[model samples]
Target chain A: MSRQTPLNAAHRKLGARMVDFAGWDMPVQYTSVIAEHEAVRTAAGLFDVSHMGEIEFHGPGALAAVNGLLTNDLSRCADGQALYAGLLNDEGGFVDDVVAYRFSAERILVCVNASNREKDFAWMTARARGCTPVDRSDEFAQLALQGPKAAAILQRLTPVQLSGVGTYRFTEGAVAGVDCIIARTGYTGEDGFELYCAPVRAEALWNALLAAGAANGLKPAGLGARDSLRTEMKYALYGNDIDDAHTPLEAGLGWIVKLDKQDFVGKAALERQKAAGVPRRLVGFELTGAGIARHGYPVLKDGQRVGEVTSGTLGPSVKKAIGIGYVPAAHSAEGSTFDVEIRGRPVAARVVKTPFWKRG
Target chain B: MGNYPGSLKYTKDHEWARAEGSRYVIGITDHAQAELGEVVFVDLPEVGKQVTAGKPFGAAESTKAASDLFAPVTGKVVKANEALKADPSALNSDPYGAGWLVELEPTDGDTSHLMDADSYVKLLG
Candidate 1:
């Protein structure tokens, strides 16, 4: 049986179409993917992201233990700051991409993908030097309120000053009479906040947010819009875009990998790979001809198969068919031509600058 | 459960064929469109192309994935929907009407294997 989130019934009440996503019975769309995608781009959209896993480290050694596992330099972050980082295996490939929130030297929380919850906890616990990793996935239900109007809608319900919480910064406060960890972060490439609250208070918080934001065109979005929104921003989805086999350098995520930092799990292997140079790199492309490119579709150069697409979709905001794939460094340049084998036909495609949709 | 027009014949693959004189109007069912989410592109077979029963003739691309469109009866394409190229979301908004995929001139006119609305609804359950 698939696991259900705290707001599963609420989604059903909103007439959402449910699907099994990474073993969780989740809402894929409440109306249409395009509508939800546009809603987030123009107004605001709410999402039940409760399935995301949370791991906690508490002790005087928490900061060092958590920082040692991540590729990003977490020690640079001050209290109440959150940073995106990669948890790589010993071979320099990703275990999972994660967001670490530094509440203090004694308390840190890492938010991980739902599918990697059990595996990530075990990996961290085994390698942790001084502190035991605690799996807190089921303790909190997460909700994301995202878009241009997100601040206005969220400010109405929370006592915490929304403007004071800058991007990637968080503060613990009460929202709509419920205690929550209000983090100014999101995956949709929008100005928003992720509210993490107790599971028992999820329904009330969800209803309150919906009621407060209803006038501002806040719609209850689902996983469908979330996927497309992130795709437009060139954000990598675990398993689809980044995985255990592809290192951060090849995935166009070198910015997050601080190789100069103290010894991490994959430091040695990454050092060697960096010296050898990255052979293949991930690139963004748009179809020049008919047909939408999809994941697992063959990418061809001069009619010969060279690579495969990792994640693709017809971008709603951009109004074009766009995709990301891994290609040899020689072919991973801007304006390089390629063919995405759609069905049995080769449709023309061209490499382009990333983040298909840019905020104006 | 979704809207399954009673007058049309349905296939287990979720396609609907409406008999129109010697040609059959083809379109995906409402249930199929909803399950596929928003249809971003519909790849229909060109006019004069031959399509065989139980075979893929085109595809419907959604924001999430691509689903192949299978032919319900062996036929030759007489006319393919041109409107879908400009606004594919018509497939999600009006799957049975404006979203009609193609008009096929059947070689044998055989649709004995296809199910009616009742049977198709039962299959969905």
Candidate 2:
């Protein structure tokens, strides 16, 4: 049995095709994946991301404790700001990638991937000493309102002055009479706001946003559209792209790792690996042939297995089959040619620069 | 749920076949397209290729996944919807008419195992 989100009833009533995602009963699509994906790219799309987990830390040492456990330098973030970071094991491999929101000097909230919630909480609780670590997953419901018209649509309901939020910034205010933390963040590589509110008020917020965005062409998107939208931007999904066995360095997320910063988990291993040089690196590739490259498909170089696809999709915006996977650092260069084996047939492919779909 | 024409024979795999003399026009049901979301690509079997009943002859890939297209009757594929190669969205918009997959010259014209529209609608429930 899977857990249900606060908005589960609403999704079912809208005729969404439900699927078991990370042990949560989630909608894969309410209408069509392509239409929903295109809506987020062009106009706006509302997404119930309440399945994502929230872990909070509060105390005098919350900032330092959080900085010690994650890869990014949290000290650089001011109050009411959020930064993308990764939680890594001692071996530099990902425990889970998260967004740490700094609400105050002593209060921090980290949004984690749903599948890794329990494990991430346990890991953080043991390492983040001198601070209170609370698993507040059930307390909050998240909604991602994304696309070009997102701000215009959200502004219709909230008087928060969304433009002042800025990218990676958040503010607390009432949206549709419901208190929420409106953060200017999204996974779609589009301008958007992620609204976090109490679970009890999820449906009300969802309903209000939908009614507000209806005139602006807002569609109720699902996990299927989410996957395609994120893939077009080359954003790594937790279980598929990054996992306990793969490090941030190998996943092209080295920019998030602050080696010069003070001691942190995985610091020693990353430093040692940096000194020795990385053997493999992740690269984005596009299939030149007919078949779509799917996850777990082998990447071949001269009929020999060189790597395997981590995440893939027929990008709705780009209209091309694109994917990200790890290969030898030598073969990770842009324009490098390789073959992605689709059902035993090697389809020709070439590594390309990421962000396959750039907003015009 | 889409209207399953009473004139067509249906397969449990969601394919439908309409007989026209010795030839059968085959396409996936509206329910199939609805379940598959939007079709982005339709990998059709080449003309002159033999297809066995209940066996997959091609694939219809949507953004979410790729589902194999099964043949409802044994036949030699006489024609494939070439327009679908450029625009597969027709499968979602008009599954029964313009979205027809192939025209087959039946080697054994038997559709005894297939169901009618009423039976297909019952299966959907």
Candidate 3:
């Protein structure tokens, strides 16, 4: 059996449809995916994201030690700042994508995907030359409050000024007497806060926040809504849209890779891949036929397979069958035509921008 | 609406099969569609295509996931839902009515392998 989060009882109480996602028994949806998806896009939605992994790196050389482990330069990171970065193997394959939060010059917390917890923590510990890496994934719980009114909703409950935290920044404060790490980062494209608190105090804080935001139309969200929300914004989900086989350059995540930094894992390999030019690039498209494009669907050009969709689903907000996939870099141009094989028939599609849906 | 209809037989895979003279109309159970979320696409099997009981003939895509549209009883496809070709949300609106995936001429007259609404509801719980 997979592990259960602290919100498991609460999810079951809300009539959630439970599913095993990456070894966590989590709720996929409560009522409907479309309604929950629209709620987060237009209004507010609460997500139980305690299943994510959190590792604390500390010591005198913590900054340099952790910086060498990540592709992004940590020197640019200041207290209350967060950086989106990736960890890579020496061969340049992706280890995992993470969010690094710098609390002080000697302290940083890296939030990684839950499924990669053990592997990521091991990689960091094996390379800890002058610092300590602690696996604190189980010591905390997190909730994501997302939408346009997130800040307004959260401000009433917390004494701290909510507007002070900029994008990719965090504030360490108290909420309902609990030490909370409020970060302005989220998988969904909307402005939001990821609230982290003690594992023992998680349920109480969740109840407090939900109670505060109830009348404001902040409904509880689940993985189903989360998937649709991220898909609409074209955010990559590990294992589906990204994996160890793809490089940062091919995955269109080159922005997170810092080549100017000193020798880091995969630095030389990434440089070679960057210089050689990537053959396949991740691209987004909208299916033009009677069917929705989905993962594993073959993309064909004149009956020859060019690539397969990595992630595909209907965009509830945009009302379109949008999908993202890896295609030949030559066919990655906007408006380029291709066909996705759907149940034997070649469904027409066109390469568009990354996000098929945008919030107004 | 609570479960697969009583008179209709069901497959463990979730499709409901109802006998109509020499043919059977096949679609997913209300439970199936609800679990799959809002249907966005339905891949219909071509008319005259042969299918076996408990085998996949086509697929359905929804906001939640991709579900296989299984043939409840062995038959030859006679009619496929053409309206769903462009808009699959029709299934969510009326899964028992317009969302009927296909009509097939069954090779056998007996539909013993499927379940009625009462049994299907119990299976869901």
Give the number of the best model, judged by TM-score: 1
Stronger candidate by TM-score (1 vs 2): 1
lDDT (0 to 1) per candidate: 0.93, 0.92, 0.87
Tell me the deviation in Å of residue A76 in model 2.
1.7
Candidate 3 per-residue lDDT over residues A163-207, each given as its tens digit: 888999998899877899999999889999999998888888888
Per-model TM-score (chain A alone): 0.99, 0.99, 0.98
Candidate 1 per-residue lDDT, tens place, A1-360, comes to 999999999999999989999899999999988899899999999999999999999999999999899999989999999999999999999999999999998999999999999999999999988899899999999999999999999999988999999999999999999999999999999899999999999999999999999999999999999999999999999998899999999999999999888889988888899999988888999999998888889999898999889999999999899999998889999999899999989999999998999987
What's model 3's interface RMSD, roughly to a tenth of an angstrom? 1.3
Q: Quote the chain B TM-score of every prediction.
A: 0.97, 0.97, 0.92
Would you give the TM-score of chain B in model 1? 0.97
Q: List TM-scores for all candidates, in order.
A: 0.97, 0.94, 0.95
| lDDT, candidate 2, at A117 | 96
Top lDDT prediction, candidate number: 1
**Candidate 1 versus the native: TM-score?**
0.97
Write model 3 residue lDDT over B4-100, tens digit each, in one string. Answer: 5567888788888878988999888887888787777787888999998888999888786778888998889999999888777878777788889
- Superior by DockQ: candidate 2 or candidate 3: 3
Interface RMSD of each: 0.8, 1.0, 1.3
Model 2, residue A319: what's the lDDT?
A: 85
Provide the lowest-lDDT 10-residue window in model 2 chain B: B58-67
